[model samples]
Target chain A: MTDRTPDDLYDALRDRLADYGQEPPAPLWAKIRAQLPPPVAAPQLRRRRRRPIVLLGLLLTVLSAAGWQLWLVSRSGPAVMPAPQTVALGSNAPTNAAVASPASAGPSASPKLGKAALENPGMSGASISETKSSPSTATTDNLRLATQVRPDSAASRRSGPYRPQPAGSVAGPFAGGSQARNPRLAVLSRSARVRYSAGQPSLAVGSTDSSVELPTAAAFSTSGSEQGRLPVDVVVAPSAGGHKAVERSTAPVFGPVAASATDYAPGAPASLLASRPVAVLSPALPQPRVQLRTDTFSTAPAVVRRWTVQVLAGPTLTHQHLGAEPASDPSLPTGIITYLDSIVNEFSRRERMSTGYSAQVQVRRVLTGRWSLSTGLGYQEYASQTTYVASTSTSTPPILSSGVFDMAPPSPHRSTYRFLTVPIRFGYALGQSGGRLRYGLLAGIDAALYLGGNSAGKEAVPTAWSISGSPYRPLSASVSLGLDFRYRLASHLEVLAQPTATYFLNSLPRPLSGLTPHHLFGAGALLGLSYEFR
Target chain B: MPPPIAPVDEALLAACRRGESAAQYQLYQRLAYRLLGVCLRYCPNRAEAEDALQNTFVKIFTRLDQYRGQGPFEAWARRIAVTTALHAVEQHRLRHPTPGTDPDDLAADLPSAEPSALESLAAEDLLALLNTLPPGYRTVLNLYAVEGYSHQEIAELLGIAEGTSKSQLARARRLLESRLATQHYQQLP
Candidate 1:
């Protein structure tokens, strides 16, 4: 044998080699046959199981609603205003000074006064009266009286005799000099002479002696007057056994005025008067005294609206990021992105039914003021229906043990079945701060667990006449591309919706035998609600 | 074609198709030893061979229907097994590209220092020589000299040109021959 070819050498070696005497495991055939999917059952059977579940859900919903209604009814109560510890004057003062003028002077003024007095009782005695005047004698008299009385009241109230000056005496100078005077102007101008009651600060300008409580109060006066004005007095006075006074003065004098004695007792009515010329004034009115520490003045906390729940079902929800870090060494081989896509597709088909009630929780980091990146996990449970066909042949000998054999019968059957699936997916989200709708792309792996179903057991059978089965298998790998739509429900929570299409990288076993490898395409719709701490 | 004799063992195949648990166990037991032999030829060590055998069976059972019957049933199954083994080998190569001394040199050195004579070498010793070749050369040699594949066929199957296939086979043969020559020389000592 002069130079044998490599093929010849190999053939000789092959002939010399020992055989693989091992047989396939005894039960392998049984296991393979069992992989064949079962026949489909009647639709009526599935409907029978679903009806009771639906009815139970409805019943639970109705009962929950009734319980909530009863709870609300039991908790209902009368609405009462909370009383402040220190009711400063002007708590209920009109927001607009101009609007408050006519309203305060009209019939509405009576009820407002009573309510204010009842609510505050500190400034009930302070009477506000309007005046008109001429320019000549009004100046000398108004100035002299305002100057003399203010010192005496200030000194006496600070020292021994706490005599309350008439509201007219104190308001005289500024009110007289002012051309246009509001009725409430007098009460504010003469605020210094309006003595407060013993127990608390209460302005008593007149002899009405009624108790008044000013929750918030302010005074306005003209700067034209040479003499400095007194500080406005805000008071809360006690009343039941109070002295009364009448509204005696309402004169529009344009001449010089006489100085009158200022005497005040607890719970006396407040009043104002003027004898004057043109008093052009600035619009600097005293700010209403408000109880700064009370809850009433506090700002309301931000609220999360329920309608944001709709975002959870919107059409976009997915993320994009590599599962593993890129290879550091360029020389080291890298797999294509298509490989992941194929895996995702196969996985989605294997768990196709797991889309009905998917929920996800995600946490994202703010990359910038306007954008953030998010990654999280999700789970879904869904049901799917599948139909399969199977063929079988049986061999039997003739009834009698004869040489001739009888032909065996061939039988064919078709069946439909349902499967329950649970799929777990991990993905990322790109978010924007002020955008109406947040959007992103997601790429991740999903592992599906066949929960309960007949579909998992299905196996592909070959049409070949070979005694051994085809060699294909069914552990699916897939890659998917999906869109993530995020709807902001509140400050921290968002609704996410994702619609995805995936291509299976590996061919899955067909429900029936003798089929060619076909691409399995799966599309899924997922809705999830998430609350992010970041 | 005489009703195309069933390509697979029907009873065993049926059991697997039915997802029978017992059948799976039986199938694993029956095919494991033979697959293990195939795996051993491609793997550098016993541990790697066992892993390849397990993986091969898994792929075989999972993708059973992909076999289209262009070849013998055994050939198709063996192809799957061999592919699985090669995949494992590729992975190993990726992880440890420079796995110390080249197996060819190691085999030649082993016999050079040993007292054993080449003419008295046992079957096990021959197998050891075959194992000492590098993964690429060993795989080609086995496919060409043991599995009876033509150089052209090996080239197509391995995604290499026919010339590369021939060169690799020649290199593998030269290494083995050198190791045998060293063993023969050491015997003179």
Candidate 2:
């Protein structure tokens, strides 16, 4: 056979050099030994030991905070104000007059007047009696009522704006025994344990309220002395037993009212005043002209209006599917085509889904009851491991020289993709707002910026390496749905667990040889804490 | 023909697996010369080959648990040496300007040595001839001929087209044959 044949020449060359060997420098082993990694079990053991302690610590902290918040809510009293007592209407009484029953004019007035009387308005006489035994009164209580005084009284005759004084000093002619026989008029004096002061055409009466204090509801101001005053009128209700009334017109109870013949009527049948069991009436004054303004404050439950901040982190499982066909470059040799097909097959075979992690901090705004909107910055990492196996057996169209050659063993290569994400989500809460346990649903879109990533294995195969630049759109987006579970640890703090599923809207394509792109899907349950501001 | 390979000592491998420093050192001493020879075939210089040898041994020790005693340990170790050497060559080519474009420029990067006289030479030093070739041609030749890789395997290993690997190997063989003929003719007297 001619030795000029390529195979013959190569075989001769391989046979001669097959037993080749050479000594390396003495320092080589020490260099390799220096790069050795520490044992793997230690770090894993430490991580395992740390988990339960952290969970227990978190539980203890939540319990302590919940107890503290409950204590605080109880000590702070009710967060809402009570309703005002409704003034019973009398037939002959002026519409603008604010009159009280003589039975309540005593110093033993019930602090539970507003609630009990309003609850049983038809049997208010019995309700007031039942409520009078209640000692649960507001620590700081004061009720103010505005009334008009008659111009003929010395209190109203003063020029300019009349300076107010103690209720006793301005009692006028109704100060002494006249106050006792007609307790309705006495309700405005010092004997009733009330503070009353009068200005031109206006009186300010302050009394201890056993229940609610409505200062703004009972205040009035007159601009000048030109504003005329109407005579103060008293309408007393009959007792529960139909007790005879002490006639106010029997004496000069009110100077202006007693002097007017038309206004004063002694022994007038109380029946003409009202059809109810008890009625207190005031003679209708011409142009009594009192501007009565009842400023009502809302009693609705207070809403949590603070901005909530949530920090979340979790382990994420990512699934990636890459689809590609070999490059159809027919101009290349048949061997190259075969090689490209092998590469695609190898890549598909080696790729595997793996777990990664994601973390984020979010600020949420409660737009209305049970509805919220949140946006935050987050980071997500996805990893895929590809294993490349080496072969030792000789292939067809074998080596020019017949000999065994070394090949690298099978190795696992991990390719990671990192993204800086911005998520905007809307949430709807389920169940009561202040309850300790609550559930919610969330839906949103997350936009991501492709942060650079690195591969953890052999770089020999370009298709197995981390992908970037072309084919990988620098920007990507995904739609996610989540079930959010929240446990309120305190008034302002809560623990949150959200199980989420996200599907990427865009694809990250493999470089070279790979034509079709791959989409990523992720599922994770994130645990976090949310704190609301006071 | 297959190269000569020593048998693996199971007891020594077990000790190395247990992270014994003495056993690791003994394993390194036993295998260093052969793996270094394997490294020299692909790397451009002895120093780079030595560096490749160091990396090869590091990989072998760290991944020793993965070795399942299928073939002789030497064959497995030699394979690691070849991969490490190829990685070094690839890194060197990337750092420099495109040396593959001009074969003469690529050959100039290697050290020049005199050919041994015929008859006096016990065996033809195929390695010296390989050193005279350019990096691309020499790598293709080493993988396809000496390493027994198919054109498709060579393409995947070197990240090149199979046609390119085939053509490069042909050129490398022609150069080697002509040089060998010249050496024989000069030593004919």
Candidate 3:
């Protein structure tokens, strides 16, 4: 044999071993198959099933809220009438303002101007001219109250300004109860508009600081009275009995004057009971009227776009796979890779779901009526426990030699992974937009970039095994689905609860050699506060 | 020499990604022979080499998703086999260290083998000579000489100093020379 240089030897080894081949043992296949985990269900296939269920649930929530709003609209009815009360009119002089006596007539009546020889110009049923009777001098300057009360007729229920009846068609106010005996006298003035609600007369007027209820026979029919500085005479004729003196007292009644108990005779007509409290005023009030118009009470619906910023934090449940290296002895029943696994049952232990947490700041903008787009940045952390059985022997032995184990091994317990997340989400609000409480469905893509990580355990000795290097991809993305529930706590602040589910679009790289790669599935609920810009 | 291993089919890899059992088996069948050759170069014996082969396949099937299609699938699989075999060698050394022949303290004074002796040896003879060396020497030799790895890369892979990798490779060559000399003399007798 001739001598060879070190370079020649290396070259020879390289050239000769380049085409090396060996027959694998027959049992190798069986061993490998036994060791492999069950076939993984394709993420896409599972994802397809998951997406529809969430969409269906979101649709149902939206539909249910819409249906409820419709039901409420359909069940609406007219304005409710108020209870009856007696009212008294006060004046400085003894005037000949006679009350209209309607036995079967409703509250509405035609206002006829009487050729009054008295100071007051005109009088009508349920019409109180505050300008003439008001005790205050300031109110006398700009205030004018010429009102006409109408009965509940088809024409009266029609919503509009009051219209005057034809002149000389009926008896005037000076005609007393003679002309108003016919219940068809539904007359009103043309300058102001008023509607009676809940017994308090709703008065609309221009530049008027105060309003008083109409003085009606129905108001005086209830038997109650109060002391007053001014004296006034009120006479009510019962529809059944002949004209009985309702109040013929000379007593000074400055406040409300009610009918005496004798006026409520057993045979008295209850025609006023069918009457809703009526207070009508002329529509021709001054320009820029502060008076309430019942026809203008219904407002048009408006669309509002909102922008919000939110901060969210919550606990998370993470599902991942931390597979172990193949066991040195493949014949071992459990197929554990080492004593570390032998002690921990790492196969099942690593498969257990772990708990984690995350916090994020988000900005959401309403794109239009019910759709919104959201983007946010966040930090997330997940911790998994791994047991490492380290050898405590200090003697560094030669190659292919066993170590001297003088003491028991220490097991390191936990490995933690942290990520920073950027997410872009599209949202569809589930319920009515104008309500204090609302729900929405969100679908998004969340990109998670791996941050730093560390392992924690009792390190009694420098073991051969340790957690080092980047086992996970630097960047990964996930499909995120969430249900967002929010309640408005103030004009610009809201409380939020968002339950989320995330499926990683790709798998996490293995942390240890011979371990399987795994995808991460996470579910969490985030409670947060949102501030909206008006 | 055995027929060159065929390049892995893309459809087979896609099917494997979908977790098809038949595709996994087919992939295993295609790569097993070549990977076993890699394992044998690092391992001390056939049983241990087969163990490494089993580990290599398990890793391949489980982590096949990591393959980004940047290179040939066969090359990726071969890299896995090499790493697995190296890990096996490390584990064996830790469990059963040779007392006097520390890999770091290997003899540098041994005579180099004759070039004519190496030229006369077949690939099988070369592999047999490689098996006689210590695990550390075998590892360094396989990585540096046969696998075309640099000293720095071998050092990183084996968790040793770069200088140590060079010394180990030098010692492994001298040991191979000594073994070939003994075999040639025994044949002369």
Candidate 4:
């Protein structure tokens, strides 16, 4: 009997086999209890979720917002990163040659270190503080670092007359790579000790007093190749002891990059990029070598202790439970639930996705290198849809039939929610310290106060099916996660794009169920620009 | 032929149709275990089958207005229960169906054996055998052999071509018989 084939067993036992396992439908009952609304009190579980609209219109509007002053900066390239805080200048103000010649940054030596190189004969102190490749350094220590005459003593001791080097000039042992090179290094004879009797600050092109003047190209003689014409300017200024500021330069004064715009106009000598490494001719020391500090002016503002502000606006997505106002008849099975569900599902289709826009203006404080805390006030609007079904009879009759055709309900309709949000986020900026394009990440929690929102349900006509107005709650809490991409158009102006997601902890709409909360959350791709307030 | 509706059940059904909580509960208790067994053979596990059972009862009560004293209420209820299980299977959303390489050819290649050993099989063994078939194969076999639905009816019911139903039933039978033969040979040794 035990060895019989499947045919014999089934032929004998077909339909006779009772409940094989005594397993009651316990979990099934639980799901029904959880999902189905009670006969008297319907479950308010929200099945609707938010979907983000492609919203190309919004994106184009933000991008072309000519009148909206995001104060856009243009950075299709990388900014030069600020160097390390290896050298401190103390109280002695040092002139920055890097402002004049970006590629000429020498070893990061303090003013004292540079001066020591100037006084000592046999000393070859090439203290080149390696330039940081990252353009996003917001540290205080790096801000405290100051520029010096030249990078190190190697330039002071190297035995070569000052001559203009081409842009590709090898950055000897002081540094490497094809950086902007000043050919006229004016390499001092090893024995020279350059110092100012009146503490005349070392002169560089950009650091020159506004009163400093340059000579016409005809007045100056070019000593290098046509591309790199070195203008022979012998400048003499009244030392600090004399309050009067005067320029005696027949020579061309130029901040290589800035000079092109200001000092060296269209007809001005184009040789600044190729000009001699301009040293401060103390009018006493024959050779005073100056190295440019390429770190942007904003790089070392760590001492400025400034708090910044930015604005973020993007399309966010989330879901909320909508409309628990039932139109069910107690006559149907499960009464109101069955009737209401049928009317909503079979007649008027309800939308499950919530689409919204989030715009926040945030105030950020740099807590440390690349780390900042930002808190912002923002406004968000979320929209969802439902249809209304009404009876054809005169008075507002309860749902009377299981027949979907009983009332011809209007097509789908929409519901909107607006919230005033206060969000606090912790952010980390990644990329070059002073680079044009910056990338970062931020995470935060928010307490979103629901500003009074309007609920427009489809207007009900007697005998017609229409959707009821979805109710709203006053407040909701949520968490946000996002990635930020930024472009620095100017020293103080930056355009930013942050794509983010916000998850809510409580439901936005009061659905029929008391225990179940229809929490809504959203995602937004925020694109806005920030201006440094300080 | 299906059995007639009992008078006591008829009274209970009427009460349930009217959404009487106690009567609905009574109806669920009496038929739930039996319906659950039918749901179980088609589902991957007990929990899913229970879900199918719950949906079946909900459907039964909601569509009670249309149930017109046709055949027997249990038979109609069991039909709903069976189809609900198939619907649950469809909801699983199986992906990447291969290009059908002629179901007829596949059915032809499979080894066949008389499932005579079914006489010795307990309900658990039968369920075990049923579970071994793929979802489509199990569904087709359950409808055709157990539920007595023809291939054409099964095709219309499942939204498949009639040929697909016949082939799936054949493959299901082949797989079950092979397994039965192996079990029978093992027991004999």
Candidate 5:
């Protein structure tokens, strides 16, 4: 072993120092005892503070998405039509004529079918009771008249624009109690109503309805004053007892009906009709033809209109600034603009408000005339914040009822809720329903249920952490109030925007007892599109 | 004189934990010198080692609840003393810029009093040889050989890499070997 190995040398050296121990200098333990600290819950020297980052992230995403949607909602298309709808025909100055018996005249497919009856020219003015003939001869001659006249030739006579007679100017169809005497001719007038047609005219019944459907519905709304039944001259079927004299307007429903067979003029652009509500008339019944002088295009036929079903979807948003209330106009004007500015500034802070979002589908049912009832289902999300303050002062202060945020501690307690909502709204129409610009007022309440949420107490800082009880209510129900403004983009499409405010009925408590109770008031807007199933 | 009384370390520890001042003193006196050696091997000088020794005793008394009593009390006390000594060295470095701590600097500035007097000396006397080495090399050697620590564990404690710990230990061993080869096992000066 002339050459010692490295490991052997290292072991020999380590063996020498293994049991080493020596005396420390004097007064050592005394120096150490002086530096001791008070006992702590845990020996961890550092604690971490995390901001409400998830809340802020959710808020940012909602705001960005809502802003983009709002931009899209603001976009609109031009659907203007130049064809004069509801254009009156003929030289006859419109008279305030009461409507004639629409049931008294049956539309004769053969022009010659009525020619034999009209052989006596004065019969146009004669009443049914005045016409007396042997019943067997009257029935046989009417049947022969129906067979002998050519239906194809009658189409040639429909070669002119229709003239609208003043419905009030014409004699009432129910005049002389004729309908009472003949059970088949009875028709009733109820609430004020208006009817809309694409190229066809829709008639809203009487005062029972406040909203009127105008002919040439969407882009060309007839003035509300123009709403009423077609000026008298519609055809009605006489009693099967014996053929009677009938009052008929010479105006053809459409000159183009026979030429195009599709009824409306073929040359007219379909896009113009798209902007207005299209009235689908049963092909069996033609419009009550009006006799008018030289006009280029045909007008809508007057017939009782049907109820319209409107569906709309769109994006909407609303925000009530943090620490804000619904603004009320001042009873008296104040001269100080700066004071007004200061008040606005106080309510305009963003930090005080919590924003939420929702997606909704609505179906509006137009009722009698001007009033409609609306209801829809929506998924809504909203958030609110409350704060708890640590009181350093020994003496207690009175708790505030309005909001406890002012005197509370530095820590903020936040609560969030997701809700499914059902809203019942009532609307009153201000103008004709088919017009380019229609105005209305909507008042509604949304019944909602809480889906899920975070409680403020769970996030309270250590200084404010004093939870002996739960700070949240069960997730059952909540309610909101809103006002929606509607605008129509097309016959089937409308845009609705509602500024809404939500109130959580239950009061939430902060982590620390005796802190101000937490109440959440969230305000935002909901936007949606409406589609009508006419 | 009569044979030295046996150390009733367990009973002394139990009494010391009950706040008996006399028992605490007895326990401290019994173990202080041994722990002082551990601190001194890590510390750059005796004053710092003495301060570390004092801190270790204070912590042991204040945190006696931490002891599970699975191992001997001396080993537990020895660990605390070593850690305290290492902490003192780190604190010194942070407060004052460190001077050169390589073996070359040790040889050039601190002249050896008796360099060849280690191999034949008793194991208890080997502390003088450790003190002659650079601080980094001496700490690595002390932790690895005496405390039975792995290079990775020594690296973590000293805040260096495992390779650096191994190299430091090797250098300290080489310096000791060279010194040992130059002398015979002679009695202390």
Candidate 6:
């Protein structure tokens, strides 16, 4: 019988098959691609050679500049001297001049004046008058002594003829004849025999030395005594049992006498005693004003302090499906699927030593729930051990032989590894749920900075050695999916668990002697603590 | 006459490759009713036919890469569809025991109808007749008359002897002939 083709049957079946056509789901492609093995590339020797040259140039330039700047700064010692102090005292002397000269001669050489007297000509009853005398010849010893004793009183103002008396005199208006017999003010005037009705003063300085009877509630009284040349004692008695006394002294005054009396309560009137005999003073009298001026200048400048710290450590498991490939070997006929699993145990040990604690300040803007946008600089050190395996087996040895090369099998190889990755992530927080127990999803890109690693100790004899082609290269681009969980401990502190799945897009440098390049699929789960402030 | 190639049909093919949901729905709308007719020739009932059609599409997309550029895309797709339908039939057989009926008696009751008359019949009428056949008979008949597989090829595919395949085809034809003859008589009365 002649061979008859089944053309018609095939055509009929073809006609019927047109009835069913549809597409698969979207996740199918993603899952399938994830299962395939990554492509291998030999590390380019030219690029490798150029990278070190560029890095060396950069290092040299930075070192040179830093060294020069450090040298220059060291050569120039402390930049500025301490400033002088500003002492607020009772004298009318200018701050700079009073700080330069001893206080005894300085304040009294100048005309007695109040704040309004300096600002207006006739307001405070004092005027400026210049004298053409030599600095050494201008003697104001008595006036300076009077100024140091009681600078705020009307009695001190009367010690200088150029000074103006207060509008109300000590014994002028409130001293009535019959009200000057009060027993309370009688102690103020020894020679004046006087009596007050109930609230009046017993003696008045302006009255005659005759016995006077007045109300006991007499509100005004005055008494005076002479020491050497001018009136040394001037006392005013108030019906409230309070009195003011002025005393004159002649000595080189270093500071205000009011400051010398530590028991001079504020807003209280007390008896004032002045040394009367004028005498030459020592040149080395301690100037409390000058000491105060220097103290104010010695203080340090105001500054803000901030401290940020993070620590991370945890165990993690990650599974990455490379992709499906056509069966290259008869032993695995269906196809080869690359699956990567990593069991990582890591510890992030950190210790921060600081003294003299300061407040932590944060200038972060809240972007979403429990998440904030922050622009800051930080330093982190990360290290991890990664175990890697390739799905394909080759009988040929690798072209370059590093220490790791002798360990790979002729069929396929598996190794436990270690490396450091410093990843800086910039992305948005997709969402977060639960308050104390929070979970958030983030998609971002990370830069994996490789340190180095040691290959697994277990070695398999090479069955197939290849010298022409390189195995898969290490991945470089880090497209990551991050899941974060945080438990807030305090207002500014939290403990967090962050699991990240990173897919590297670029290949890594091949270790010279291994079957596979350093390419890897890495995932990490980190349990860390963070401190924040507002 | 050749059917007009609508722009939407091309668009649907492109989108289906990209796994678009809208294109998949459009493809289902255009092909579901027709595929149900094809599925019924191998299925014992309407429910089983619809199930087979659903399974056929799922397999077609999954194995789309197996369809090399050697032949028409439609023809390749049809082979998958038919194979999927036959697999459904085999699965059904494992679940249910065969009925005790004489093949000759069942064949004697088959309907006799002209090819033109069968062609003019509505899809629904053809589907109804196909659903009435037993699972074994319906599967063989669809593979022979509708799908156009030779008895040898059918035997190889179904894992049965060539003689069994020929006998099954003859029995299926006689039953359809008697069913058609009865319909003609009913019309005459």
| Model 1 chain A: ten consecutive residues of lowest lDDT | A90-99
Any runs in candidate 2 off by more than 4 Å, and if so which? Answer: A1-306, A323-345, A387-409, A456-471, A510-516, B1-189
lDDT of 3 by residue, A1-534 (tens): 022235777787777786587778787898888877656678864775466456545644564455445433432323321212112221211122222222211122211211111112122222222221222221211221122212112122112221111222111111122111222222222212222222433232321221222333344333243211111222222112111111211111111221221122222223331121111121222111112111111111111225689999999887665434432334322321343233223322434466788888998866555667677799877655444433322221111112322223335444556788877777889878799999999898777777856432111122222122343556677789999999999988999998998877766553332334456677999889999875
Instruction: List per-prediction Cα lDDT, in the order shown.
Output: 0.37, 0.49, 0.50, 0.46, 0.41, 0.35
The CAPRI category of model 3 is: acceptable
What 10-residue stretch in candidate 2 chain B is worst by lDDT? B110-119
> DockQ (C-alpha) of model 1?
0.06
User: What is the two-chain DockQ of model 4?
Assistant: 0.07
Residue-wise lDDT of candidate 2 within A1-534, one digit each (tens)? 111235755565555544566877768776777755433354574665465446545644564465445433433332321111112111111111122222222333332223322232222112011100111221112111111221122112222122211222222211111112234431221111111123222221222222221111122112111121112333233222222222211111221221121123223333332222222233333212111111101111232344699999999887676555443323222322233244334554566877878999998866555667777899998776666433322221111111122224566766677888887777889888677999989998787767856432221233222233222446677889998899989888999999998888766542322234567778999899999875
Report the TM-score of the second chain of model 5 against its true counterpart: 0.77
C-alpha lDDT of residue A35 in model 3: 75
Q: Which is better, 2 or 6, measured by lDDT?
A: 2
> Which DockQ-derived CAPRI band holds candidate 2?
incorrect
Q: Is candidate 2 or candidate 4 better by DockQ?
A: 2
TM-score of each: 0.31, 0.39, 0.48, 0.31, 0.29, 0.29
Write model 4 residue lDDT over B1-189, tens digit each, in one string: 222234336788877655566777777666776778888877888767877777777666655644546577777778777767775665543433445454344345454556567766777887887787677787777766666666655654565667877677667777777777767766785
- Write model 1 residue lDDT over A1-534, tens digit each, in one string: 122373443443344332322233445334433433332344653665466456545644564465445433332322222221111111001100011122122333323322222222223222122111222122333322221222112222222221223444432222211112222322232111221111223322121222222211122123222111211221212111112100111111111111111122212233231221122221232222211111110111101111122223222222112223221222211221122223222322333232234444444433322223343444333333222211121110011011111112322221111112112233344655486578777554333222322222212111232212322222233456677677777776777777876554444333332223433344667677766542
Give stretches of model 1 more than 4 Å off.
Answer: A1-534, B1-8, B99-121, B184-189
- The TM-score of candidate 2's chain A against the true chain A comes to 0.42
**Model 4: residues with Cα > 4 Å off, grouped in runs:** A1-306, A321-349, A387-398, A402-407, A454-470, A510-516, B1-189
| Order of quality (TM-score) | 3, 2, 4, 1, 5, 6
> Which candidate achieves the best lDDT against the true structure?
3
Cα lDDT, model 3, residue A28: 81
Candidate 5 residue lDDT tens string, A314-337: 332322222233222232112111
What's model 6's interface RMSD, roughly to a tenth of an angstrom? 16.4
Tens-digit per-residue lDDT, B1-189, candidate 6: 222333234455655544455556565555444555566666666556556666555444433323334455555555655655665665566567576687677666355665444544454565566566776677777777666667755654565667888788667667766665666567664
lDDT of 4 by residue, A1-534 (tens): 122234443454356443343456466655543443343312221212211112323433443353122211111112321211011110011111111111222122233233323233222222222122111231223312422323332233222322222333221111111111221221222212212122333322312111112222221222122212212221211111211111111112222212212122233221432222222222222222223222212123342444677987878665564334444333333523343354433333344566778888987766555666677799987766545434332212222321223443345545456778877777788877677888889887776666754332211221211122223445567788999888988888889898888777666544431212345667779999887765
